[model samples]
Target chain A: MEVRDLNFTYPDGTLALEDVSMDVHAGEIVAIIGPNGAGKTTLLLHLNGTLRGNGVVKICGRRVEEYDVKELVKKVGLVFQDPDDQLFMPTLYDDIAFGPINLGLDEQEVRRRVEEVLSEFRLFEYRDKCPHHLSYGERKKAALAAVLAMKPEILALDEPTANLDPKSVRELITAIKKINEEGVTVIISTHNLEILPQIADRIYLMNKTVLAEGESDKILADVSLLERAGLL
Target chain B: MHQEIDKYAHNSPLCNLDPRMKVISLMTLIFSVVLLPRLELVSFALLFSIALLFVSRLPLRFALHFLKWPFMFITFFLLIMPFSIEGTPVFSVGNVIATYEGLKYGVLIALRASSAVILALIMIATTKFGTLLKALEKLKVPNALIQILMFSYRYSFTFAQEFDRMRLAARARGFNPKTSMRTLRVLGSMAGMLFVKSYERAERVFWAMRARGYDGSVRMLSELKAGRRDWAFACFIIAFAALLHLVGG
Candidate 1:
């Protein structure tokens, strides 16, 4: 996945992402970090064509604008920040089954995918439970399961560790690592530098623009760099 | 407590009865009561007895309060008697005359409506609102309406919470809703903004739905099926209603 010279602004004329550029190779966990309003989420949305930025954003060498949303959503699964915004079905099973069914997969295939993710996330017990009733951590896992059930090539998450407890964060990191091992390129946006120490192999410093990108140990070690980006 | 008015709030023998059975039986009884053309003491007594027997063990005080509301409704409905179809006069007072047949007609209609109200209240008191919706869904009611009802039930609380938050925010800023027109306008705008925000939220919800794999149809985790008890209860209620309908009609 790659983005070059991408720019975007809100209708009220606030520049969100300015000339942001980055790349995610075949299989690696990339963490995009900055202070609030850093446009990390905007950049992630651009990868899936949810928010179309000005310049080129490519997934597997195919430009984002070239592929339709329905097609793109399958290839580049983007998980939003809010679980409430993601899980809408009455039950866990239905929520997980939605993507495969929409893609016109047969009923048997859809159920298989849902069953697979349920076991993977250890959400098998929550198959019948409403998403709203689940704990925040569980809901996040369920959201991730919904994305994983789609079997996307590239997985992008906004604030993957934002509201999670330590245990849930650990569980999520483990789940993402497994997905990464499956040859899926994973991108996560977060502000917590502590959790990223182990999980995030690559770091992208986004400060209303693509500030810097390199090894996690090198980029996150620079207190001056983080401070300059209002993350201190 | 008024909580007794909600029947499905606890576990009991009556709580386990099929909703369809309760609905059908109550509807039949109510129809039978309505069929009475005059204030027949026997039929009135029978209706009252059935209503009492149905509600007796659950909670009597709550039932009495529940019964009071229907009396007012009966009286209001009776007011239309004079304007309805003219009938044999029972008495005369200057220009106003009381007709026996009209009074009878009014009494019968009032009886039916009150019976319906009582039965419905008892059913509501006994059944949880969520289960009641599920029961309706099982009855092959339109899926669209059932979905709407379910969504509304879930989100109405959210809307209330949002309204409360907006109210508190307004209050913190020293804005009073009742003191002046400007504040009233602000309140109105707040409501408008809430609707807009909820609509926007609905769009976000759609995106969420898309993320999760929501196709056109909304699916439930469990399919509500009538068990043996449901079947037996349904058969008994149907037989009873049939007998009443035939015997009363």
Candidate 2:
């Protein structure tokens, strides 16, 4: 995945992104770390054509706008921070099957995918329950499972660790690593620095633009850079 | 929190019955009750509704609690009927005549309304809301209407929780509500904030849906299959409704 000279301004005249450029190779876990209002969410929204900015976003060597919207979502699955927003279907089972059903898959295929994700996430017991009934940690996993059921090549998550307990955070990191091992490129934007070194293969520290990009160890060692980005 | 009726519905022995059959049978029963010409026949319908409540295994106390609102609403109209209608006077209070014909008319309306409401409640109390909506969808209800009902039912709980949180926040800040201009102002502001928050949430939800390949329409796995028992139960209920109509006629 590649983004070049991306610039985005909200309708209220706030510049959310400024000439941002980045790249992510296949089978790598990339993390975008920054302070609040750093346009981390806006950038992730552009990955799946949810928002059209002023620059090019390429997935698998094709321009974002070049592929149809339906086809684009299958290639890059974007999970919102709030599971409530993403899991709007009446039940968790329906929510997980939503994307595949929209992809025009047959009923049997959709059911298979939903069952696969439910067992993988250990959410089979709550399949018929409403999303609101699940705990925060379960909701988070269910949201990710909902997106993963589509089998996207690139999974983009916004604030995956926000509002989670320590155990849930660790479990989410492990899940991300497991997904990466299975060959799904993962990109997450978060301000949580504790899990950065553990899950991130590379880190991009940014506040509206690419401040710095390097291996996780190099970025973690740069105190002055972290201070300037407000991580301190 | 789950609604009281929803709890019973999920646990009801009748829950496993196909929702389409349940809806069709109960709806037919409601129509028969409403169409009954004699107040005595309406009594039979009311008895039948009580029988349904028993079969649903819903406790009498819960049913009475659920009936309170509709009964209160219907009472307002029933009170005015005896005073407004022209008939033979049965009694008088402060020159206001209460007539036997008006009393009979009021009783008929009350019985009919109660019977219909009870039957409808039985239908709702035996099926999950989502399954009920799906049954409606399969019964030729428009997809757009079904979608609207589905989302409204699903998000009502979310919004209710949001409102509860705001209320708690107000209480934590030492805010006390009473009937006054100040209280009204605070309430108005809270309502305005809720509207703004809901608007923002709606936009985010739309984006989320689009991200998951949502086109204009929604599709779900239809796991409803009517078996022989469902058909038999539906036939029995419909036949019973016809018998009531015939006996009344």
Candidate 3:
């Protein structure tokens, strides 16, 4: 994945991202680290065409504009920051099957995908449970399962660990690592810097735009850079 | 209010019954009670609903509590009817007379209202809200209307939680709401803020739906099917309603 000179402004005249450029190699776990309002989410939205900006975003050698929203979603699965926002279906199974069903897959195939992803996330038991009834950690996992059921090539997560307990955070880190190992290029935007070295291969520090980008360890060790980006 | 109903719904023995069958059965009973001219037919319908409440294992106390609001409305209607409809006067209060014919008419109307409310409550108590919404969709209700109902039902709980949190925050700040203009102003602002926040949340929710590849029609993971027992139950309800219609006439 590649983004070049991306610029975006909200309708309310707020500059979300300005001249942002980054590249995510296949099978790499990329972390976007920044303070609040640092345009990390804005950039992720651009990757999947959820927000159209003034530059280039290419996935698999094709510009994002070349793909329709549905086609873009098939290749790039974007999970919202809030599980409450992402998991809108009544039950976890339906939430997971939503994408497959929308893709017009057969009922049997949809059911199969829902079960496969639920089991993959170890959320099989919560299949019939309401999303609201699930714990915050479980809802986050269910949100991931909903996206993973689509079998996207690129998995983009926004703040995957926000508001999670330590145990839940550790579990999520392991799950994300396993998902990355399975060859899906993962991009996560988070302020949680402690787990960056453990999970992310590369880190992009941002404050409204990319301030620095390098290997995860080099970026994490740079106290000055972290201070400059208001992330420390 | 919703939590209590949902709790009973989740635990009801008829939870697994097809919502379509329940809707058909209970709606038939409600309509029979409403359209029946005689009190005996309506009484039969009310008795049938009570039996259903018992069969579903819902507490009678809870059901009666749920009925309280509608019962109040029915009582007020019954109370006014005797004075409004003039007929053979039974009692006079300063020229505002209560008539024998009007009393009978009011009692019949109130009975019909109560029977309909009971039948409707039976269906709600035994069905999960999501299943109920899907059943409405399957019944060929308009998609837009169903979607509206679905969102309202889904988020009312979330809104309630938000409201509680806001109230707590206010109380923490030493804001005591009493019957005063200041209290009224504070509540008005809170409501306005809630509306604004909910509007923003709705926008984000729509974008989230779009990201998940949601089309116009919301599809469920599983389709509801009527089993042998469901069909039998529906048949029994229809036959009983028909029998009541004949016998009461």
Q: Pick the candidate with the highest DockQ.
A: 2
| Model 3 Cα lDDT, one tens digit per residue, A68-129 | 77888889999888888777766678778888888788999999998998888889998877
Q: Candidate 1's residue-wise lDDT over B140-180, tens digit each?
A: 77878876875665555456767889999989999876788
Alpha-carbon runs more than 4 Å astray in model 1:
A65-69, A105-112, B1-147, B160-196, B219-229, B239-244
Error of 2 at B190 (Å): 2.1
Local distance difference test, candidate 3:
0.86
lDDT per residue as tens, model 2, A50-162: 88899999999999999999889999999889998888877899889989999999999999999999999899999988787899889999999999999999999999999
lDDT of 2 by residue, B6-71 (tens): 667777778889999999998998898888889888998899888888988987888888899999
DockQ of each: 0.32, 0.78, 0.60
How do all models score by TM-score?
A: 0.72, 0.94, 0.93
**lDDT tens digits, residues B1-249, model 3?**
344465678788888889999898878877877888876667667777777778888888888888999999999989988888878999978879999888888988998998888778878877877788789888888988877877776677677877888999999999999999999999999999899988988877887787777778787755888999999988998888777778877
Off by over 4 Å in 3: B90-102, B247-249
Query: Which 10 consecutive positions of candidate 2 chain B have the poorest summed lDDT?
Result: B1-10
How far is B55's C-alpha from truth in model 1 (Å)? 9.6
Task: Give model 1's docking category.
Answer: acceptable
